[model samples]
Target: MTTAMGAALRRIQLGNALSAFGNGFTIPYLFVYVSQVRNLGASTAGVVLATLAVAALLVLPLTGRVIDRRGPLPVAIAGTVSAAVGSLGLGFADSKVLVVAAAAALGAGFAVIQPALATMIVWCSTPTTRSRAFAMQFFLNNLGLGIGGLLGGQLVDPSNASSFVRLFAIESAMFLVLGVAVATVRLPKAPRLGDVVPAGEGAKGGWRSLLGDRAMVQLCVLGFVMFFACYGQFESGLAAFAVEVTRISPATLGIALAANTAAIVLTQFAVLRLVDGRRRSRVVALVGLIWTVAWIAAGVSGLVPGAHGVATALLISTYALFGIGESMLAPTVAPLVADLAPARLVGQYNSAFALVKQLAMAVGPAVGGLMAGGGMYGAYIVLLIVCALGITALALRLGRRLTPEQDNPRLLARRSEPVAGSAAAPAPVACSASH
Candidate 1:
C-alpha cells in the first residue's frame, strides 16, 4: 500500500473504533430506555427495536446507487450525519413517534455506512491486502463494542433516566467524529461508475447486472445463512435460550456475551493468519463447522440435567465458539464480496450483501424467539444446527464457481512473483478486485 493509502486506512480505522466505542454506550440500553424509562411499554420498545431493521430494509435499496454515483466518502459522511441526528434525538425523545422516528434514522444511517465504508476500504487497498483490511475492521469493531459495553455497563442505572440520555449523547458525538475523520481522507484514484463503464451503465441495469453474477447470487445465499445461524441469534434468540432452557442467570448471560467478544478480539489476528491465502470458501466452511459445534453445545447445555455449573460452562463455550467462528469470517467473507464485484458496482454488491444480512437478522430472531418462546427449545437448537450445516454445504458449492484468483488471491500473488533462479513466474490470474 502507498503511504497515502495507508494513512487513509488508518484514519478510517480510528474513526470507526471511536464511533463503535460510542455505540457501545447505547446499544445494550436502548430497549430498557424506551420501555421503562420513557414508559412506552414493552410493545413500543419492540416496535422501536424492529424499526431499526425495518428502516434499513426501506433505505438500503437506494444506498448503493447513491454510493456508486456520489462516491463512498460523501455517502459515509451523510450516514454519520444521519446517525448523529438520530442518536441525539433518541436522547431527548419521550413519545413513541419521536423514539421510533429517531430509531429509523439511526438504522438507516448505520445501514448506509456498511456499504459506504466497505467500498472505501476496497478503494484504499489492493486485492492482496483486502483480507487484512477487512480483518482489521472487524477486529476494531468488536474491540470497540466490547470496551464500550464494559464502560456503559458500569454507568447504567435502571433507576436513572439521565444516565441513559448521557449514553445516547456520547454515541451521537462519536458519529460526528467519524464524519470528520472520513472527510479528511485522501484516497488513491479509483474508477467511479463513469470511469469504469459508460455514464449510464449503473442506472441502466445495476441491480440486474449484480443479480446476473451467478457466483455473487450463490454467495448471497451463503451470506444469509451464515449470519442467520450465528449473529442473528446473539441478543435475542440466544440470550432468551440461555436464560430459559439453559437456566443461566442474567449475569452469567452477560459473561457469555463478554466471552464472545473476548474470543473475537483475542483470536481475530490469529484466525486471519490461518485463513490467509487459503480459499475463502474453505475458511467460511470451517466457520460453519465451528458454529455447528457451538449450536450442539447450546443444545447440550439444556439437556445437562441439574448440573448448573456444567450447563453454564457449556453455554459460555457455545458463545465463545461462535466468536471464534466470527473471527475466521472477518477475513474470509467480506473481501470475497469485494473480489466478486465489478469495480463500479462494488457499492451495489456491498449494499446487496448488507441487505441480505439485515433480512436474515430480522427473520432469525423472530423464528428463534417464537420457537424458544413456544416451548420448542429442542427445535430451536435443531434448526440452528441445520442452518450451520447448510453454511458448510453452500460454501463448498460456491467454491466451485470462483476464479482461481478470486478464491485465493494470495496464491495468485505468489505465482506472479519471479522465482529465485528464474526470469519470471507465471502471470497472475486475471481475476482481481479492480480497486
Candidate 2:
C-alpha cells in the first residue's frame, strides 16, 4: 500500500475503535438502565430494545442507496452525528415515546455506520492489503469493546440513576469525537457503475442488481444462519441456557466472556495467517465445524451429571471455541463481500449483508430464548448444530460459483503481475471526501 493509503487506513481504524468503545458503554447496560434506573419495567425496556432493531430495518435500505450515491465518508459523518444526538437524548428521556424515539435514532445511526466504514476500508486498501485491514478492524473492535465495557462497569452504580446518565454522556462524547476524527480522512474516489458502463445502463437498478447475483444471495443466506447460530445467542439465549440448565454462576459467565474476547485478540492475526492464501469458502466451512463442536461442548456442559468444576470448564471451553471460529471469519467473510461487489455497488452489497446480520441477530435470541426457556434445550442445541452443518454445505456450494480469483485472492495478486505488452497497474490515489 502507498503511504497515503496507510494514513487513510489508520484514520479509519481509529474511527472504528472510538465508535466501538462508545457503543460498549450502552450495549451492555441499556436494558438495565431502562428497566431499573428509569423504572420503565421490563416490558418497556424490551420494547426499547426492539425499537433499535425495527429502526435499523426501516432505514438500512435507504442508507445503502445514499452510500452508493454519495460515497461513504459523508454517510459516516451523518451516522455518527445522529448517534451522538440519540445517545445524548437517551440519557435524559423519561417517557416511553421519548425513549423509543431516541433509540430509533441511535439504531439508524448504528446501522449506517457499519456499511459506511466497510466501504471506506475498501476504498482505502488494495486487494493484497484488504484481508489484513479487516482483521485489524475486528481486532481493534474487540479490544475497544473489552476496554470500554471494563471501564463502563467501573463507572456505573446500580443504586444511582444519575450514574447511568453519566455513562451515556461519555458514550455520546466518544461518538462525537469519532465523527470529528473520521471527517478529516481523505479516501480514494469511489467508482460508480456509470464509470464502468454506458450512461444510464446500470445506474437504475440498485438492490435489484445486487439480488441478481446468485453467489451473493447464497452468501447472505449463509451469513444469516452463521450469525443466528452464534452471535445471536451470545448474551440472551446462551446466557439464559447457562443459568437455567448448567447452573453457571455470574462470575463464571464473566470469565467465559473474557475468555472469548481474549482468545479473539490473541488469535486473530494467527488465524488470519492460516486462512490467507487458502480458499475462503473452505475456511468458512472450517469455522462451521469448529462452532458445531462448540455447541456440542455447550450441550455436554448442561447434560453432564458430574462435578461443577467439569461443567464450568466445558462452558468456558465452548466460548473459547466460538472465539476461535470468530477469529477465522474475521478475515474471510468481510473481504469476500468486497471482492464480490461490482466496483460501484460495494456499499449496496455491504449494506445488504449487514441487514441480513441484523435480522439474524434479531431473530436468533428470540428463538433461542424460547427454546431454552420452554424446556426445549435439547432442540435448541440440535437446531444450531444443524445450522452449523448447513454453513459447511452452503459454503462448499458457493465456492463452486466463485472464480479462482474471487476464491483465492493471493493467486489473483500473483497472476496480475505485468506481462511483456501489458500496461502496469495504476498507483493508488487519495481523493478528498465529499462535503
Candidate 3:
C-alpha cells in the first residue's frame, strides 16, 4: 500500500474506534433508559428496539447503491451526521414516540455506516492486507466499546435521569467527530455505478450480477446461520439460559460478557498470526468446532445447576470460548466477502452481507426469545449446537467454490516470492476455483 492509503486507513480506524466508544455508552444502558429512566413501559422499550431493526432494513438496500454511485466517503459522512442527530435527540426525548423515532434514525445511520466503512477499508487495502485490516478494525471496535462501557457504567446512576442524558450527549459528540475525520480521508478514484453496470440496467443489473456469484450467495447463507447461532443468542437465548436454567445472577452474566471481550482484545493478534497463511474456509470451520464446544459447555452448566459454583464457571468458560471463536472469525469472514466481490461491486456486497447480519440479529432474537420464554431451554441448546455444526459443513462446501487465491490468499504472496538463485521472477501459477 502507498503512504496515502495507509494514512487514510489509520484515520478511518481511529474514527471508527471513537464512534464505537460512544455507541458503547448507550448499548448497555439503552434498555433501562427507555423502559424505566424515560418512564416508558417495557412494551414501549420493545418497540424502540424493534424500530431500530426496522429502520436498518429500510435503509441498507438503498445504502449500497448510493455508496457504489457516490463513493463511501460521502455516504459515511452522511451516516455519521444522521447518527449524531439521532443520538442527540435520544438524550432529551422522554416520550415513547420521540424515543422510538430517535432509535429509527440511529438504526438507519448505523446500517449505512457499517457497509460504508467496510468498503472504505476494502478500497484502502490490497487483497493481501485486507484480512489484517478488518481484523484490526474488529479488535479496535471491541476494545473501544469495552472501555466505554466500563467508564459509562461508573458514571451512570439509575435514580438520576440527567446522567443518562449526559451519556447520550457524549455519544452524539463522538459521532460528529467521526464525520469530521471521514471528511478528511482522500479515497482512491472508485468505479461508479455506470462503470460497473450497463447504462439502461442500473442497480438491478448490479444485484443480478451479485446474486449470480454462487460463492457469495453461499457465504451469505453461511453468514446468516453463523450470526443466528452465536451472536443472536448472546443476550437472548444464552443469557436467558444462564439466568433461568443455570440460575446465575445478572452480575455474573456481565462478568462472562467481559471475559468474552477480554478474550478477543487480548488474543486477537496472536490468533491473527495463527490463522495467517491458512485457508479461510477451514479457519471458519475451526471456529464452528470451537463454538460447538461453547454451546455444549453452556448446556452442561444448566444440567449441573445444583452446583452453583460449577455452573457459573462452566457458563463463564462458555462465553470465553465463544470469544475465542470470534477472534478466529474476525480475519476470515469479511475478507472472504471482499475476495468474492468484483472490485467495482465491493460496496454492494458489503451492504448485502450487512443486511443478512441484521436479518439474523432480528430473527435470531425472536426465535431464541420464544424458546427461552416458553421454557424450551433443552431444545434451544440442541438447535444452536446443530447450527454451529452446520457452519462447519457450509464452510467446507463453500471452499469448493472458491479460487485458491480467494480461499488462501497467502498462496498469492508465495506465488510472487523471489525464486532462489534466479534474477527473473517465477512463472505465474495457474489456479482454478473448482480444482
TM-score of model 2 relative to the true fold? Answer: 0.96
Report the Cα lDDT for residue 235, model 2. Answer: 83
Weakest lDDT window of 10 consecutive positions for candidate 3: 426-435
Q: Record all residue pairs in model 1 with backbone atoms less than 3 Å apart, i.e. clashing.
A: none
lDDT scores in order: 0.89, 0.87, 0.89
Q: What are the runs in model 3 whose C-alpha is more than 4 Å off?
A: 192-195, 417-435
Expressed as tens digits, the lDDT of each residue in 1-435 for candidate 2 is 787778778878987898788777877899988898888889999999999999898778777777877889899998988888889889999989999999999998888989999998988887878999999999999998888899999999988988888888988888888788778887666684364433464434767788899989999999999999899999877888788888988889999999999999999999988888999999999988999899898889998756778888999999999999999998889999999998878888899999999999999999987887788988888998899889999899999999888888998899978898899987766544333
Most accurate candidate by TM-score: 2
Write the candidate numbers in order of decreasing lDDT.
Answer: 3, 1, 2
Q: Determine which window of 10 residues in candidate 1 has minimal summed lDDT.
A: 426-435
Clashing pairs in 2: none
lDDT per residue for candidate 1 within 1-435, as digits (tens), equals 666677778888899999999999999888889999889999999999999999999888888888877788899999999999999999899999999999999999988988999998898887898899999999999999989988999998989888888899999999999999888876544563354755566544889988899999999999999888888898878899899889999999999999999999999999889888798888888888999999999999999868989999999999999999999998888999999998878888899999999999999888888887798888888889999999999999999999989999988677777768977544321212223
Task: Give the C-alpha miss distance for residue 297 in model 2, angstroms.
Answer: 0.3
TM-scores for all candidates: the values are 0.95, 0.96, 0.95
